[model samples]
Target: MSATERGESKIRIRPMEPMDIDRVLAIDSKITGVRRAATYTDLIIGDLGKIPDLSFVAEVDGEVQGFLLARRDYFGEPFSEEGMIHILGVEPDYWRQGIATRMVDALAETCQEKKLNAVRIMIDERDDQLQSLFERSGFRRGKLVDYTKKFKK
Candidate 1:
């Protein structure tokens, strides 16, 4: 059996709530290579809590399976509402069940409602499945580079 065959259903995607932070962070840590601080909850909640209009979660049997987080921003131009998807993840156990696709659809709906011109996602080069999902959801590749710098203690 392949990895895709192993990751079958048993998951669902829905709007995110303040209470889903912990489980979401666990999933985030597994998907991304970041050591999240204990205060990660407070930080994600603080940024997304008030703006419920821009975030979502994926759950299964009352547990958070994944999450998609977006923020309102523009490309350094006028006040245009461009949404950026900062993170998207589906637990390894539930990889190919369309959970992440659903989350992206939800975000796209929200962006449409807000009259945003475009929604952007920076996918990890290694995440082929996720890149395919984004492509199916009407996101095309952009001619830009995504850069990041981490601070050390």
Candidate 2:
């Protein structure tokens, strides 16, 4: 069912702006049950690509209902540059409204315009639901492996 079918207003996907930061924090905190305000603040500051607004938001009647934060990555000279999707959050009230899918599509459109052939998001091995969503959205297991190293501060 579409948003209108569910009685929600039409969702407009557009480039995110600095002004949307507060609402973005609210939606993300709602989804993850944690407040990472500082993280998002840093992520969006001067992070937009040359394309103006590489990240985007989903709005309904001028109110932000969801957001997707992304950036371009350079892997030195050996790997091709690609777009990296760092975060996606929709207000809990707007779940199942296809808002996330639309946000991803918006990013894909931006990627296409930039002539980028790849976009990537990291999902935990156990998060089957999120993995399924991206898979349905045309992502497959790529060659790159997700790894990390930890250090004491």
Candidate 3:
């Protein structure tokens, strides 16, 4: 079977709650090699917890193995009120088990119900693996530049 194909593992995709923040942080930290507790706490679990449809967590046998955080709002011209995926993380041990894709599928279902025709995500250009994952989940590159500037205290 292919990596994208489901195996004996049955992943349950459900709306993410604030309670799932700890597991989400652990999975993210393991994958990225950096703990981002503040970002997840301040932005995701704090804010998106109230609006749960666009955010989701994947579970296998009642344990969280992955998460996908997204929001549907004005993402500018040609795709107003569309969805924007902020983060997708899966435990290293669960990689290539179709967990991440299932979470994305869950979000897609919610977007369809909410009448959101588009879902967008911006990944770091250096992250080829992430780009491939999104592509397999039906994402394509967009014509936009990510200009950035750092501010110091």
The per-residue C-alpha lDDT of model 1 at residue 69 equals 78
* TM-score-superior candidate, 2 or 3: 2
Give the alpha carbon lDDT tens digit for every residue of 1-153 in model 1.
Answer: 743466643556667776777687778677665765644434655754553347789777667887877788777556556888876678887776787888888889888888888888777889887788899988998877877798998
Measured on C-alpha atoms, candidate 2 has an lDDT of: 0.78
True-structure lDDT of candidate 1: 0.74
Clash counts per candidate, in order, are 0, 0, 0
Residue lDDT tens for model 2, 38-114: 55434454455222247888997779998888888755367767888877888887787788999998898788889
TM-scores, all candidates, are 0.71, 0.82, 0.79
Residue ranges of candidate 3 with Cα displaced over 4 Å: 1-6, 34-42, 47-53, 77-79
lDDT of each: 0.74, 0.78, 0.78
Candidate 2: worst-modelled 10 consecutive residues by lDDT: 44-53
**lDDT per residue, candidate 3, 10-44, as tens digits?**
67999887788778877877776666556553466
Better of 1 and 2 by lDDT: 2
